[model samples]
Target: MAAEFDTLAEWTAQVATDLGSSFKIPAACRGSGSLAVLDWLIDELHLSHGGSLLDCGAGMGGPAAYAVRQRSVRPLLVEPERGACRAARSLFGHPVVRASALALPVGDDSFDAAWSLGVLCTVPDQLALLTELRRVVRPTGRIGLLVFVARSSEPFPHPDGNHFPTEARLLSLVEKAGLGIEDWRGTEEMAGPTPEWQSRVEKVTAELADRHRGQRAWQLAERQSQLIGQLLADSTVTGELLTLRRR
Candidate 1:
């Protein structure tokens, strides 16, 4: 039988099944445009067999594993969280490095391409993260990123205390880190508020609360959903997908 889903939806649904409801990808990341994003990443990075791809943050290993299987690319996943690293290693069977994005353990020019999804916002030092990525990836190597960017300087309340940088600030950081932005897409253009997303969020939250007994994971899930919903509702912060090349 054909795969049930070709995008984040299937992967996240499965994650929710395995780790209760708290581990699912946010509704904001599951949309019709997700397949297009995957296609763009493959095409822009020119992924192929034997080429090394670095998955920064590498959350749950779903998207990275999907990309590797789809393109036959070798991947080295770097995740700071031990739980996430374990999950990635077990699920993808890919080599995983438990390290921070600011300090990648890989040697210089180790990867042909690198990408991160919904991770940049969690990083406090964008330049450090991007610099590490640039150092690890070969010169002129392609980089693709999808980040939640702020529309203003005011910090957005988040469970992770992540920095939601303004578009200009984020672009500046990328350029400063010696990467050139080749193209960009905004949230509305990528995955705006999808119909039924609210219901999905409610269901996930309720399920997580039940399973985790409203513990840390459940609370985090609820807060994350609230943040995403607010971002979508106010249009204050938007998801930005960028195609970049290391310089």
Candidate 2:
């Protein structure tokens, strides 16, 4: 097990290697999709040079790497997962700090902006995280966030059954933190789940279920992926991207 404070250099190497760039895409990662997650942030955030940033829940340094590549940005990343923190530091020079979203270690007015992608819903204390986010930003600094809030059609809550605040409610939570939402868009994939992945998952799951030990392992991996695919299938489950300026 990796400690929270450990530098993201030694824990996991696989996720780090996956964070590489394709020269064809101008020294950017192109594997995850046609567009990089970092590119996505840069486009939406539109940050300028000398923009100090805090990236909460930066996974394997994808967005962090993007930030550095874009404008020589040094994003301070916060991650509780040791493997992820290791990946962030190893893949990108961004400093990886072992910190919980609810209680950041940085001082007030320490950052020009804060971003946390794909991490809000599973957080146990949404309000706490928002408050902490508000604390770090200089007055008028913005928070660019990509969060997956639950909708009625979703199933299989967090493995730990954490709260999944709805998108509408999530904005209110941010407002409570003293930042007003400046952008809102809900992406819905009109089509349902793809047959190919669903079929493959069902077959693999049943096969593994025949064995007690294998069933548990397979269920965790296969079931979770299936659930994620289902919810995100039509973008019925969507991300709320907010550029909120701190008040």
Candidate 3:
């Protein structure tokens, strides 16, 4: 198992600790998707107050926490990283399970809705991940995904641990996993982040640099961020937001 120290998880955990009691922690930890995207998905999922939600591959639990604050829904977070799980629990006081997306520890049909953001490309077994998500969600439940789909056949640089699928391939995999597409849209050109959101993120970034400058964990995380930014800038991959229903 990977140690908690000198990893992106450690950096994020430290950021949460440094930003203690500040409302910016959640905003700072929200991965690729912007606030607009989250709001749209939440509205589309039709999450009711007090309903159950499962956040698979939920790193640091920022989005899950945001959902809780917005809709008062009960969230069970499943994250694979140990340090991130700890951060989520300590920072947001949410129940988090350190587990893999391929085989969730939850019971069958345990959630009203589920979602995975910026996670599909990172997992090599995309089909199994989707299948597991389907198993845990009710037959009437919805599953939302924010994926980076390949836009062209030409080879382009991408961050390590990423295996982006073409749109057609992604659709086929969804069908294979017994999921029906309710709606899909492109988010590559979604509105920019709000000033407040940007500000929160900047503060966290500045703090991380000041605290862990030249550290191995910080260097690794910075490289990963740069690679992801390059992929987005080159137009080699496009963001796709899909709302799926169990068939």
Off by over 4 Å in 3: 1-6
Please give the distance, in angstroms, between residue 108's alpha carbon in candidate 1 and its true position after superposition. Answer: 0.7
Per-residue lDDT of candidate 3, residues 148-218 (tens digit)? 99987567777767899988889899999999999897886567778877877777777778887778667
Global Cα lDDT for candidate 2: 0.59
Worst 10 residues of 2 by lDDT: 23-32
* Residue 114 lDDT in candidate 2: 82
Evaluate residue 117 in candidate 3 and report its C-alpha lDDT on the 0 to 100 scale: 92
lDDT of 1: 0.68
- When 2 and 3 are scored with TM-score, the better candidate is 3
Q: What is the C-alpha RMSD of each candidate to the true structure, in Å?
A: 6.7, 7.1, 2.1
lDDT of 3 at 110: 93
Question: What's the alpha carbon RMSD for model 1?
Answer: 6.7
Local accuracy by lDDT, each model: 0.68, 0.59, 0.81
